[model samples]
Structures are given as C-alpha cells and as structure tokens.
Target chain A: MSKLCFVTTGATAPFTALIEAILSRPSLDALLECHVTHAFVQYGTAKDVYETSAKAAREYLRQQGKETQLEIDGMDFDSSGLREQFKLVQDTKGLVVSHAGSGSILEALRFQVPLIVVPNTVLLDNHQEELAMAMDRQNYLIHGNISNLAPAIKASEEFRNKMSQFPPVTAGKERQTKSFARIMDETVGFTDFNNE
Target chain B: MLPACPALYTTTFLLATLATLLVAATLRLLTILPHTRSTPPPPRRRPGTLTRVLIVLGSGGHTHEMLALLRDLDPRRYTHRTWVVSSGDAFSASRAVAFETALAEKASRDTGEGKEEAGRWHVGPQYYTVVEIPRARRVHQSLLTTPVSAVHTLLRSLTLLYRSEGLPDLILTNGPGTACIVVLAVLVLKFFDLRGAQSRGKCKTVYVESFARVRGLSFSGKLVGRFVDRLVVQWEGLEGVSGGRAEYWGVLV
Candidate 1:
C-alpha cells in the first residue's frame, strides 16, 4: 500500500520541462513530506531527460539521508492508455501530476484521485493553459507551474478532501441540462414516450 | 449564310445568366445551412427501432473526448455504428472496437439470466464497422500538397456517405479535421438530396466542441459550427459562441 505519484507528459510531444520540474529536489522533498513512497514518470520520448533528472533528485535525497524513503522510476509511453497507472493511484489514495492535455486530464479526473495539471507553454496558441486555469478554478484540479511543481505537490495533501466530482451530476437544472445521449436522441427526433 | 450570333454568347445574356445562377446558389444555400435553414419536423422514431449513427474520431485528445461523450450510448437505439477514422490512426480504430466490446459485455450482464433479451441490445460484430479515410493534412505536410490530400479525403468521404446502408440517421463528431471533411461530404449529399439524405432527414449532425476547450472553439469547431444541426460546448463560458448556436450542456464529457 505504497503512496504513488504518477506523472504523464502526453503521448505525442515530450514535455521535458515537466519531467525536470517534477523530479526537481524541492518537488521530491515535498512528496516525501507527504509520505509518498514511490514516484513514476511517463516521459514519452524524453527518456534521457527523465533519467538525468531522476539521478540528480535521488543524489540530493541521499545527501539529506532520506534516499531510502522514496524510490523514483520512469517509463517511455504506454500504448494501452494509462488506466493501470491511474488505477494504482486510486487504490493507493495517491496523486496524479500530468501535462494539461485534455485526454489525460479527462482520464485522471474519473478515478477521483487528486490531480495536478502542468500545461506546456512552449507550444503556439496553447489553449492548455486556459483549460487548466478554468478546471483549477472549479477545484477539479490544481494548475501547477512548470517552473516549480513543489507548491502543487505541497497542496495535493490538503486538496484531496475537498476535490469536486468529475462529470458533475446536474443539480436543480437536471432535467434541463441534457446529457450527450439525450442530445443524440433528440437530434434524431426520438423523445421518450412520456415526453410528448 | 452568315451565322447569326446566338443569344447564349451575347454579353448581356451571359451576365444575366450569371446573376441568376448566383442568386439561385445563394437561395439554395439558405435552404440547407443550419442557422438560416428551416428545420423540417423530425419523423417519429420509436425506441428499439433500427438506427445507424456515424461517429468521427481523430487522434488522441479528440478521440478520447468523443468516447467519453458517448459513454451512455444505448446500443438498443443506435444499433448500427459507423466509426470514421483518419488513415494511419490505429489507436482510434482499436478504441472503437474496445468500446463496442464493452457495450456487448454490458448488455450481456444486464440480461445475464434472460438470454433472449440479451440479443436485442447486443453490439455484435455486424452491428458496427470502422471506416478509415486518408488524412486531410498530415503533420509537417507541405501546405502546397495539403489541398491535394484534403480533396482526396473529401472524395473518399463522399463515397463513404453514399455507400453506407442508405444514409446514417445521425452524425456525431467532436471538432476534428477529418470530421469537418465528413460533415462537408454530408452537406454535399444533402445539397443534392442524394439518396434522400435531406428529404428523409438523414445525416443530422451534432458536433461537440472538445471538453478541453474551456475558453473558445477549436479550428475545426469554428468551421463545422455553422453547419451542424447542433453545436454543443461543455463549459458555460463558451455557451454563446458561433453566434449563440453553441449549446451549453454542462461538461458533457
């Protein structure tokens, strides 16, 4: 029952900055402070960057005499999606730190694990920043800065208790807020028998 | 005998014909375009009726969101599925198959004891088919050659729409480049009333802007927004986009 922090940097473009930021010494200290024992990074074609970052972070921990407390690992990409990785996080009541790619955000939220989203700002016309801010404002996730992930790592501890649900259940306007299924049915003119 | 100048070649006549043709095309466009077009009353469709739906899937992000949006799909209603993917997109194709397999398993679970009822809503192999067309524009593809590939995609889309079992009753997509081409092909079919696509109210399209779009629509969203029967956005901030045609459905994905 080891606490795990799963970090994914998307599948296409490699966000080496995110890998370095998460594995930074300060971020590792924050994780250890929160009792996190294992850290897994999905580097996605940035193996060298992940390796170098992990080595530096581990050496830093060794100097502080906390090297045996936390273990760090890395992997290329997972072709079958990251379901297994997210499931481990859920079972361990751990955290998911991911690039603010919509695909990973949507997947991680469903597992009800506290998530920290770090958007890659180098890409032109990056809407990932907007999405991260909006989702963060709603308390769906924490928007982590690429320059320093230590703050987000520290926040993950207190954030777990009050996290909002994903695919939110419609409240007072439940009847009016149509699900995608109903929209599909209505677009084709199929109303349930009683609706007419 | 000197040949009399024909009326067809006369400058005034040609100009008048050109004007008339322009007016006719405009009028035709008004009759079919989503916002300006008159929506005919939809025909009655009962539950359990055999219906076909076309789903357009793109690379990673769009494909994932589209699947989440369809999580509650009732196999009993949408009996036949046509999954459209861009060429070389093996991930999307495999995900579609997995979705169908999951649906079949769920159907069986719901009717575990009642074998007869299981067959009714079961998503068997024959119930869904995946069709792949050429990419509209590949990554790093020269801009000069983009039109060539785009036209190729469009032509294949036309064949896909026409060759399906009659026309699909519904088209579901989430703003992918290839999805835009398919919607364009559907418009072409409806324009010509090919196979009663328009007259029969077939190919009714619903385009969902990606869940990731919190602030605005994507490039494909902007292009397909005006033409789709319904344009849905997940976030409330984007409710009034595309001249208020975008419907805010409260984070559908």
Candidate 2:
C-alpha cells in the first residue's frame, strides 16, 4: 500500500526548476508527512539536471535517515502518453506534480488525482501561468510555485476531497450548454433524426 | 480635336468597366466570408447523409486538443474524415489513425450486432484519409519566404477541398497555421462558388481556440476568427473575443 507521487516536466521543454523544487528538502518532508513512499519523476530530456537534483535529494534523505522510507526514480518520456503513470496515481490515491502544460493538466485531471501545477516562467510569452491561475481559481488544480512547492504539496491533503471535476458534468446549466459532439453536429446542420 | 475626343471616350469606358468589376468582386467577397456577428440557421439534414468532415491537426498541443475535442465524434454521422496534418507531423497523422481505430472499437462495442464489422468499422481508406500539406510557416522560417510556403499551403488545401466525391460538409479545426490556411482556401472555394460550394452550404468552418489560451485568443485564433463560422473558446473570459464572435462552450476539450 505504498503511496506514489508522480512528477512530469513535459516532453518538449524540460522544466528543470520543477524537478529541483519537487526534490527539495521541504518538499520531501511534506511528502513524508503525507505518507508518500515512491517518488517517480518523468524528467524528459533533462537527464543531467535530474541526476544532479536526485543525487542531492538522496544525500538529504540519507542525512535525515529516511532513505528506506521514500524511494526516487526517473524516466525520459512516454511516447504512448502518461496513462499508466496517471493510473498508478489513481490506484494509490497519490499526487501528480506537473508543469503547467494544458495537455498534461487535462489528462491528469481525468484520473481524479490531486495535481499541483507549476508553471515554468522561463519561457518567452508564457501562457502557462495564466492557464494555471485560471484552473487554480476554479479549484480544479493547485498552482505550485517553482521556488517552493511544499505549500501545494501540503494543500493536496485537504484539496483532494474538494477538487472540482474536469470536463465538468454540466459546465453551464443556466443557458443550454452543449457538448463538442453536439456542436459539431449543429455546425454541419445535422439533426439527430434517429435520436442517437 | 477628333483624336482628343476619341481618347477621352476610351478612358471613360475603361473607368466604368473597372468600377463594375470592383463592385462585383466586393459583393462576391461579402457573400463568401462568414458573417461576423451572426451565423445562418443550420439547414435540416437527415441522419446517415454521407457527410464528410475535414479536420485540421498540428503537432503537439494542437493535435492533443483536437483529439480531446473530438473524443465523442460519431463516425456514422461524419462518414468520411479527411485529416489534414503538417508534412513532418507524423505524430498527428498517427494519432488520427489511432483515433479512427478507437472509434471503430467503440462503434462495435455500442452495437453488439455489428460485432463482425469491428475489424473494419468506420476505418481504413473508405471512412477516413490523412492528407499531409507543407507547413504554412515552419518554426523560424524566414519572414521573406513565408509567403512562398503560405501559397503552397493554400494550393494544397484547395486541391484537398475539391475532391471528386465533393467538398467537406464541415471543416473542424483548432489553432494552427495550417488550419488558418485551410479555412482561407474554403473561403476561396465559396467566393467563386466552385461546384456550388456556397450555394450548397459546404465547407462550413468551426475553429476552437486552444484550452491553454485563458486570457486571450491565440495568434491563429485572431487570424481566422472573423472568417470562421463559429469561433469556440473554452474559457469564459474569452467569450467575446474576435469582435464578439467567440462562443463560450464551457471547457470543451
């Protein structure tokens, strides 16, 4: 019954800061408090960065004498998508820490795991911050700061029960809201004669 | 005096002809481009009408969002799908194929009686096609040569739209340069009324802004906003974008 914490830094641009923040001492203490055992990181083209941070994290864990309690590992990228990783999080009722990429956010939310979205502020004309803020405001996710992710890690315990559903059951109930499928049919002028 | 009089008459005639042509072209443009504020009521169409839909998918986020948006697409309704992908975007192309395969599986699962057709249900060459056109503007492509690639994309799009089977009944796209060009090509077909494109109400476009665009429309969204029949934004804050044409569908995809 080992609880897992999965961290994905996205595939294209590596969010090295996220890796460092997640493995920092404060973040580790928060994970231990939450009883998380296995810490998995999807580094994605940041092998050197991951190695450096992971080594320091291991050293800190050794000094704290909690080396056996929490384990850490890393992988490059998953071409077939992160379904397996997300599924593991769901089974364990674990947490997912990800860069503020909409694709990852959308996919991870479907699994109903508590997610901490950290927006990489290094990129030029970055829209990730705006998206993370909006989603956070909606209570769909917790927006984590790259400088210190411990607060968000601690917040996940309470936020898990109250997390809003993704692809909401009824996004807008006031005015007849429609699904994308229905919209496509409407755009094409196709009325469902068969009621399908 | 006779030579001067003839020259003046020739100049007057030429000016009048140019004015008439300009007026006609403007009227044609007005007819072709989608109305900014309002869309015409969707004409009634019966089920299983052999409808075709053209989907524009780009690399990475665009492709992912497009697939998510179309998660519940009915293959029976949109019988033929022409997936337009950028030339080097193998991921998008393969994802399109994978999506169709998933559709086939779902189709079989929904109707147990059609279990035998599961192997070929709404898949293969008959049900869908993946078309690759050159990128409208490759990443870091020099501004000087962008027009050249843009023209190439427009021509390729035109050829794809003018198939023998007929034009797509609907063109569904998200934010992508290739999608913008495809929408432009559809407008061109309608402007000339090529094979009754506008008269028959073919090539209707629906552009969905990316889910990541929370504050404002993306660059492609701004470009194709006015021309597309429907500009759908997932976030509420972006509802009135593109001169109040953006529709808020509440987090579609």
Please tell me how candidate 1 rates in CAPRI terms: medium
Pairs that clash in candidate 2 = none
The list of candidate 2 runs beyond 4 A from truth reads A193-196, B1-17, B36-38, B112-121
Model 1 spans with C-alpha error above 4 angstroms: A173-175, A193-196, B1-9, B36-41, B112-119
Interface RMSD of each: 1.3, 1.2
- Measure candidate 2: CA RMSD: 2.8
Q: Residue A33 in model 2: shift from native, Å?
A: 2.5
**Residue pairs with backbone overlap in model 1:** none
Candidate 1 chain B minimal-lDDT segment of 10 residues: B111-120
Lowest-lDDT window of 10 residues in candidate 2 chain A?
A187-196
Candidate 1 C-alpha lDDT tens digits along B134-211? 999998999999999999999999999998776899999997788999999988998888999977888999899988
Q: Pick the candidate with the highest DockQ.
A: 1
